[model samples]
Target: MEFSLLGPVGVATGAGELVLGPAKRRSVLALLLLQPNITVTIEQFMSSLWEDEPPAHARTVVQGHVSRLRQMLAEGGAEAYGVELVTRGSSYLLRLPEELIDAHRFSGLMALARPESAPQDAVSLLREALGLWRGPALSGTVSGAQFAAAAHALEERRLAAVGALATAHGALGEHDHAAAILYAEAAANPLREGLVAALMQALYRGGRQSDAINWFHRTRQLLGEELGVDPGERLTRAYEEILRAEAVATQPPARTQPPARQQPSGPVDPRVQPAPERAQQPSIPRQQGHAPAAQGRSPGSGTTGGPGGTDSTVDTGSTGGTRGTGSTGGAPDRSTAPRFLPRPPARFLGRETQLAELTRWLTDTGSGESPIAVVTGPAGVGKTACAVQWSHRYASAFPDGQLFADLGGFGEGAEATPTAVLREFLLGLGTPPEQIPPSADAASALYRSLVARRRVLVVLDNARSSAQVRPLLPGGPGCATIVTSRSRLDGLVVTDVARPVPVQVLGTDEGVALLGTMLGHDRVAEEPDAARALVALCEGLPLALRAAAAQLTARPRWRLARLAAALGDERRRLSLLSAEDTGIAAALRNSVARLSADDARLLSQLAMGTGREVDALAMAALAGSDPERARDGLDRLAEMHLVDEAATDRYVISTLVQLFARDKEAGEGGSPPASTER
Candidate 1:
């Protein structure tokens, strides 16, 4: 049996291809195939399928698709072929050998080809790997948008392999073949400096000097117009080489002489050559139809004659490092200063205790290393808002700039990779794109080196795990890092000495204050009871309160009680608490989505069970599991802020979250008997 997601998602057997159902079903299959032998949670399926706005019945629909897929695979002799779709705790896993998946095979082949010692073999292997692509990956799947980035990354890998193959060809002196392969790719990705550089070099070596120069000018113009930046060092160097070649070609044969001798070794002037790390200073490119400037002159030193005999002195300090005939420098000031922090919310309230705790942790000097704080809570609990507000308030303490990144751990799209985050951080610190290393480890090392001794504040938001934030931490004692997540991040606390500061939902008074801030004080004061009732319905979650306030503000004539009345319905309250852009339901959904299958099932079961608090024994009865397993699942829920361990052996679920669970359980048409053990 063979599974393919490189193009249309499908299963193939020795007899024939199995009948994969509609787009949604094919999407499920594609997602499972993409990560074989791993359980994909129902929430993940729903998120990928609907892109963060799954319908109320998304879970049931996903279950139906999975069932149908399993039946189809069984009918196609899946058991005999060792291909099985198995159900686990709260997720489903597709069991298959790595060799059976084409994408996996392609990845393995690419990995083998990356080493330098086997260029010839790499060329053959890469060619074979590229041949596996039938068309756009997961093209026929319903959730194509969900896999758009993955498809693009896969295509990028293919193009990179093409580049590698061209290099191998060039190593064998097949310049024409290399140039041919690069031309198409270069044209397709016109702004790719590496591809353009490779193509330009190949063209020049293949005796197409004029064509290479033309390509350079065209690409430079396109980059300047589109990106508002000049080409990087690689492209500039390639262009300079072509220009030198052109200069030699056009010179009179009889008058031609050997090139000038190299400048004598001496103490390099600071103005002429900045520090090695600051080597990203942009060089002046000689204009076409103009006489080239004299070489070996100090940068920003003396005026030189241009094509029409005009004085052209390079301005070394021009912003973005562009050169022109001006005395002021063109290079950007504070090239290493990154301003990545997002703007703080306009009406952030509460979290005073959490903020004070974070400030204490950050200001403490005895820890002997840079301080790290993890701000964790359930979704919509204002963790991010609190972190941002505190950072802004204490921005003066850290004289250095603040760095921020949303890891997107729970985003509808693919989570941000550490390598990509490191690259962004490096660039933010004024590290030249060319200087930034390709690997995550190397980039992280460079980042630590840059931020060493700098009093910088780093905020890593929406982190999924400790591993994602670990690489981004600065090693300097003066630096401080704040991480916000739905997870408790106990690992960071235990291993990295990070102080844990949990951001809880607002108190009743605090919630009212927040609502008043958004909807005006008089309106909230005019109907205090109604406002409190609305706040109660929102469960004191800042996101929910703000959403309710927005809806009230939109309908000024509608009394606060009217809004509360609409929210009084348990079935419609979650939907009612939402406004145009903010919603309690959406925020709660993100938290629930992060739960494991068993944990999620237990949560729903508890929601359907009687009473606000459930003991371990009672939960065990509800889940039909042992007390230990039930306690473990409940503990996991508590860690996620989905439930509260109110006392010893007593757990309480939030009323709003309970509503969400009830909706989930109701959709599945199952309800455990009310707990009586407690």
Candidate 2:
């Protein structure tokens, strides 16, 4: 359970209730939880907790309470739920997901149970919202006027929920139950005209017209005495309709617009736009005659269903969704096809074997297994580029079009959530944003249904784990999914029978060809030996080669030998292989950022190994742990492609990764890395 502002203020866990120390402390936490994820200043805490007579050192007192609260939350491992208390200058923010707060969750349920929603769903949603309240709102935690007012507001909302619940019940033709629900709430809030109206309507619908008239009269008198006002429009309408013995509508008729065929997420939909870079990014290639992409596109849009090209209007987080040339036009309306494949990163290098294997796997899926290609390799080895290049190469094979999502699996940013990705995928595939359900599993079902027999290519790039990719995988054997990640994604292979396609760095000749293409052939032809040195220095990594080639292209006067010599210095080597702030160092930093602190420290330590190939015993000595622990860490690191097992017990720390680890060691003021490979 999360914070329970509807009844008492509390922070709870799976175990039991947490003792929230003092009343003032509970008050502080209650106020923060009431408005989670927003800045709450010390002054607001003081005002809410003490009102006019706060202590002289109120700020210090509030700060102490927050400090202790932070420690308490940390001890509970609240970070697992993405909950944390952040400090912003003079204010404090209690950040947590919406579902973690009872108030927010209740409010979300209430919003979900719209008058137009299905009666059963609305009833269930309303009852769940009502059940969140245990007792009087903030009963034990209200220290001052502010908390009392907050409690009053919540109680008022509860009355509205009760009325809505009654309306939902009536929609299901359970008029007796509706009258019962409204009676209790109406009695409690006699002056609430909406509840009074609902009670009247429910009573009449249950065939108690006289009882309905009597209740309305009682409420009318109470309202007059309380505020000297006549009954509101809702109350008057219900009363007039009942006197005529007419059946009155308790709420709007249930929506018949096919669910999942339109926006149903109501509010707070997690639909993702393409990654932020697409704003100014050059449009990726479309089929030869396809309409040009709308400028802002936004990649998260565009899902091609299958053979019929079941398409949807794409929303690229901008004014217009990308429109393909081959749109359906008619007298009623005209809609264009949606495209989601990203542009080729650069001129693709040699990956014919990898491409052939991908084609072969999909072809072999004739055995009835849906092919999910788990493309794993070291960072900067061109896994995404290879997949994209192949996708572009075989566009004709899947006329339904391609769907692409950058999972943001490995980077400084938060991982792209499955629900968020599913929303985007559904939006791309043909589902409207409103039809995209709030539930990850539900949206995923919609995805499977939409793509059941479609030959769409679902490419999930930069995935972090198998769990992240599982829900996004296409269900039909007619469709295929290509998942690229630094991790091997072994879980997918075991459970989903996914084929593992490993992409390594380019060959020396392949690297030269790619670099020569980026630079001019004349330049490489002029200094063939230096061109070879440039590729060799980069270990044939396409990303590194691209970065180097891009730089030389920028400075045409700079000789390949000069750039090659600069890269030879181990100190500047990683830094030299960068274009536009994205280099080997940055990629390594992102990869290390995802590892455990111990694993990261072990990585730097491993770089200090005695030789390129080291056994578990040697790693144990380097990591200062026993053999078993060292071996386990090595296995994990190898899974992430940071190290490779060269033999039964020996591992090879590639020269590039080694340099990155050593650089990290020095930057952090650790013992200098071994003069050479450890």
Residue-wise lDDT of candidate 2 within 535-590, one digit each (tens)? 89999888888778755753446789999998999888887785433567778777
Candidate whose lDDT is highest: 1
Give candidate 2 misplaced runs (Cα > 4 Å): 1-337, 671-678
Give the total clashing residue pairs for model 1. Answer: 9
Candidates in order have lDDT scores of 0.71, 0.71
RMSD of each: 22.6, 25.1
Please give the range of 10 consecutive residues that has the lowest summed lDDT in model 1. 289-298
lDDT of 1 at 163: 86
